[model samples]
Target chain A: MKVLVPIKRAVDYNVRVRVKNDGSGVELNGVKMSVNPFDEIANEEALRLKEKGVVTEVVVATIGVAKAEDQLRSELARGADRAIHVVADQDIQPLQAARILKKLVEDEGIDLVLMGKQAIDDDANQTGQMLATLLGWPQATFASKVEIEGQTARVDREIDAGIETLEVDLPAVITADLRLNEPRFIKLPDIMKAKRKPLDKRELGDFDIDVPTLEVTETRPPSGREPGRMVKDVDELIATLKDKGLV
Target chain B: MSKILIVAETLSGELHPTTAKAVACAQAIGGDIHVAVFGSGDQGPAQAAAEIEGVTEVLYVQHDENNAARAATLAPQVVALAAEGYSHLLAANTTTGKDLMPRVAALLGVPQVTDIMAVHGPRDFDRPIYAGNAITRVQAPGDFVLVGTVRTASFGAAGGGNSAAVSDKAVDAELPSHTRLVEQKTGGGDRPDLQTASRVVSGGRALGSSENFDIIFKLADALGAGAGASRAAVDAGYVPNDMQVGQTGKIIAPDLYIACGISGAIQHLAGIKDAGTIVAINNDENAPIFEIADLGLVGDLFEVVPQLTEKLG
Candidate 1:
C-alpha cells in the first residue's frame, strides 16, 4: 500500500519562540526551521512500515511557502520515495490543510496518511482528524504503535488516561505521538541519492481551500514566573510548606 | 448571550471530572450553558452534569453506537445537536476532546480553537502556542458558530450545588463503522489523576529503576498528590507512559508541583509552567528546573525524597 506522510516546516522545537512586537504572530524571520518533531516521527514510522514490507511506497507532502521545500527535501533524504510541495504564501489553518490533503489523497490514490498529532507552531492538533472526517475514513491519533495486517491496522495510542488500542481498516489516518519511534539520521549517501528523487510542486489553489473563520487578535509572551526563595534544608522546606499551608 | 453546548466526557458511563472544569470555562464566557452527555448504557453522567452549578440544561443522548465513545461517532451527533442554534461548542481538552472537537468543527465548516486558556470576550480568547512558550489571543468571527476546547488545567472545576434539568435527546446522524476500540490499559491506579490533582510529585531519570520509583509514589501517597514522571523517566522504563508530564504528555496545572531529580527541558517546563507553586529538588543546584522553581533544594532525591515523605507523614 502507498502511504502518505504529511510534514510541516515549523520553528525548531528547541527554539524559544518570541511574539512579534506588532502582535501579528510569532517571529519567524530567519529563525531556525526544521521538520516538526512529531512529523519527523511520522516519517520515521512510514519508512519502517516500508522496511517491514507492509507499505509498498512512502511519499511525504507539505503545505507551506517556498522555503518549506527544504523540509520536503530533508524528508526525501530520510528515504521517502518522493515528495509533494504545495506552495502557499498565506497562512494555512488546520482545516485548509486538511482539505488540501484530502484532495492529494484522492489524486494520489493513497491508502494510509501518517502525520503529527499537532504542529508545535499552531498547536491545533486538528488536521488528521479533520481530514479523516472529510473523507469519512477512520482515524487513530497520537499513535505510538501501528501494525498492519492485510487491510486492517492496529494502532496503540498514548492518551491522557493510558494506552488505548484501536483497530481501523486501510485508508485510515494515523497521527504520530512522540514515542512512535526514534527517527533515523540522514546518511551522506542517502542525501546524495535524494538529490535525484522526484519532487513534485503544486499550488495551494490547485485544491479547494476553505476561508479561515478564526483570526488572531494578539500575540504575546506568557506571564513570567519569578523564582522564589530557596530553603536551607529539609527542615526549612517542610517549615515553608507548613507556613504556606501547602502540606 | 451566546448559547453554549458542552460535550460531557465519560468513561464506563461515568462523568469525568474534567467536564466540570469545562463548565467553569463556560461560566466565564457568560453563556446559557448546556451539556450534552452521550452514553449507551447509563444516565448517571447526565444527572451528574446537571449538578454543575452553572449548567442550564443537560441533554442525554443514548445509542448503541455511543458505547465506545469513539470520536467518529460522537462528532456527527454533536454536530446534529449543535444545529439547535447553539452559538459555541466546547469540550475539555482531554484526549477525547482533542480527538473529537476538530471533526465537529470540520463538519460544521468552522475553524476550531484548541486549548482556550482565557476568555477575553465571546469571540476573543487566549491560547498557548509552541507548547505554552508563547500565548496568542484568537478571535472567531461572530458570523459562524464557534468550536473550541477548554484547557481544564487553567480553570478550577465548577462547584456542584444547583440541579439543572436533564432531558433525553435524540440525534439523527449517520455513524460509521470504520473505527473500533480494542481495549484501554490504564495505570497509576488508586492515585489522583495527574491532570486534575491539586498536588503532584514527579520523578525523572535520576530515579534509575522502577523499584526506585516507589519512593516518589510513597511521597505522593503521603501528601495525597498524584504521581507523574518526566519523559526521560518514562522513556527509560522507570514508569509507564501515562505518568509522563511534558509537552507530548500531560499538561498539568496543579496547586503545587514537586520535581524530583528532573533537569527541566523546555518541553518538561511547558507542561508545568501553569502550575501554581513549583518546587525543585535536585542534587545539581544549577539544573534548569531551579530557574523557575518557586522553591529549590539541593540534595539527592533518594535521601531527600524519603526524608520529605517522612516529614509529610
Candidate 2:
C-alpha cells in the first residue's frame, strides 16, 4: 500500500501572529515557519504504517512556493520515502489545492492520502474533505486512531459528542487531529539520507484547475481585552465576583 | 436578491441551537432564506426550523440511510439541493457543519469560508485566524455561489415567532456506500453542554489524576455549571477529549468561567476570551491565567476547589 501525506508550511504554533499595520494581512516578515502540527502528525502516522510493513512507501507532498521544499525535505528526513512539491507562486485556496491534490493522487496511484485536519495559518479545515469530494472517495476526518486491515481503514474520530468509529474502504482520505500521534524528531543521520532521496517538482498550471473563488479584503487584530486586577485571596476573589454579580 | 440556503442541524429530532444561530447569520446577509433539513423520518426539527425568524421556507429531505449524522451521505443531498438556484450556502461552524460543508463546497466547485464571525455584505465576511488572535475580512466572487460556515458563538439565535412553510424534498444524489458508522460512544451526563452553558468550571493538568478530577466536577455541579477541561488535562488523560476547551478543542463563550489549577496557555485562553468574567484559582501567583482573569486567587486547587464547592453549596 502506498500512503501520501500532504504537508503545509505554516506560522509556528507558538508565535504570536500580528495583523499588518496597514490592515492588509498578518505580518509574515521574519516570523518562524514550520510544518503544521497536525500535518506532522499525519506524516508520523504514515511513517508508522511504513515501519509496520503495512505501507510499501510514504510520499510527502506540499503546495507552496519554492521555499516549501524545505518542509518537504524535513518530512523526508522524518521518514517519508520521497517528496512531491507543487510549486505555486501565490497562495491557492483550499478548493484549488484539493483539485491539484486529486490530480496528483491519480498520477501517483496513491492508495491513501493522510493530511492535517486544518492549517493553523488560515485555520481552514477544508482540504481533505474537499479532496475526498473531488475524487469521490470516502473521508475519515478528525481521526484519533486509525487501523488498516485488508482494504478497509477503521478510524476513531474525536467528535463534539464523543468518539465516532468509522470504517472506510481503501483509496480514501484521512485527516489527522491533534491526538493522532506525536511526530518523531528528525535525526542528523536521517537528514543526511533524506538529502539523497527523490524529490519531484511540478507546476500548478499542470493541473488545469479553476481560479480561486475567495479573496482577502483586510485583516486586523482582535479587540484587546481590558487588563484585569489581581485579588489578594479567595475571600477577595469571592467579593469581587459578588460585586460584578457573577457569582 | 440573493437566496440563502442554510443546512439545518439536529440531534434526536430537535434542532440544534447552532442552526438558529446560522439562520441569524443568513438574515444578516439580507437574503430570502431557506433551510434544508436532512434526516430519516421525524419532521420535528424541520418544523422547528420553519419557525425561525426571517426563514421563508424549510425543505425537509428524508432518506433511509440518513438516520445518523453521516457527512458522506448528507453532503451529496445538500449539493443537489444547492444546485436549485441558491446563491449562498451556510451551516453552523460545528462538528457536523465542519464535516459536511467542505464536501458540499467541493461538489459545487467553490471555495468555502469557515467560521465567519461577522458579515459585512452578502459576499464579505470576517473570520478569526490564529485562534482568534487576528480577524481577517474576506470576500467571495458574486458570480459563483458563496459557501460559508457561521460561527455560532458570535451570533444570537433567530427568534421563534412566525412559522414559514415546510415542504418535503426528494433526495436526488447517489450516496456513497464505503463510509459506514460502526458505533458511537457518547459521554453520558446530565450537566449543561459546555458550549452553551452560562457558566463553566475547567480543570487542568494540575489536577494530577483522573480520580482527582472529581473536585472540578463537584465544583461545577455545585455552581450549576458545565464541566470543561484544558487541553493539558485532556492530554494527560485526566478528562475525555470532548470535555476539552481550547483552540483545537471547543470554543465557548459563557457568562462566567472558573479556571481551576489551569496555567493559561494562549490556545486555552482563546476558547474562553469571550467569556464574560474569568476567575482563576492556582497556587502559582504568577500563572498566566491571572493576566486575563477578573478575579485571581493564589491557593492550592486541592484545598481551594473543595472550599469553593462547599461555599457554593
The TM-scores of all predictions, comma-separated, are 0.99, 0.97
Q: What tens digits encode model 1's per-residue C-alpha lDDT throughout A1-247? A: 9999999999998788888888888999889999999999999999999999999999999999999988998999999999999999988999999999999999999999999999999899999999998988999999999999999999999988889999998889999998899999999898888989999999877888855668888888889998677787999999888888899
Q: Give me candidate 2's TM-score against the actual structure.
A: 0.97
Question: What TM-score does model 1 score on chain A?
Answer: 0.98
lDDT of 1 by residue, B1-313 (tens): 8999999998656799999999999989998999999988699999999999899999999999888888988999999999999989999999999999999998987899999999998889999999998899999876688899998879899999879999999899999888999999888478999988999999999999999999999999999999999999999998999999988799999999999999999999999998989999999988999999999999989999999999888
CAPRI-style class, candidate 2: high
Candidate 2, superposed: residue stretches over 4 Å from native: none
Please list all clashing residue pairs in model 2, or write none if there are none.
none
Give Cα-based local distance difference scores for all models: 0.92, 0.91
Q: After superposition, how far is residue B307 of candidate 1 from its true place, in Å?
A: 0.9
Give lDDT tens digits, candidate 2, residues A108-193. Answer: 99999999999999999999999999899999999999999999999999888778999999889999999999999999999899
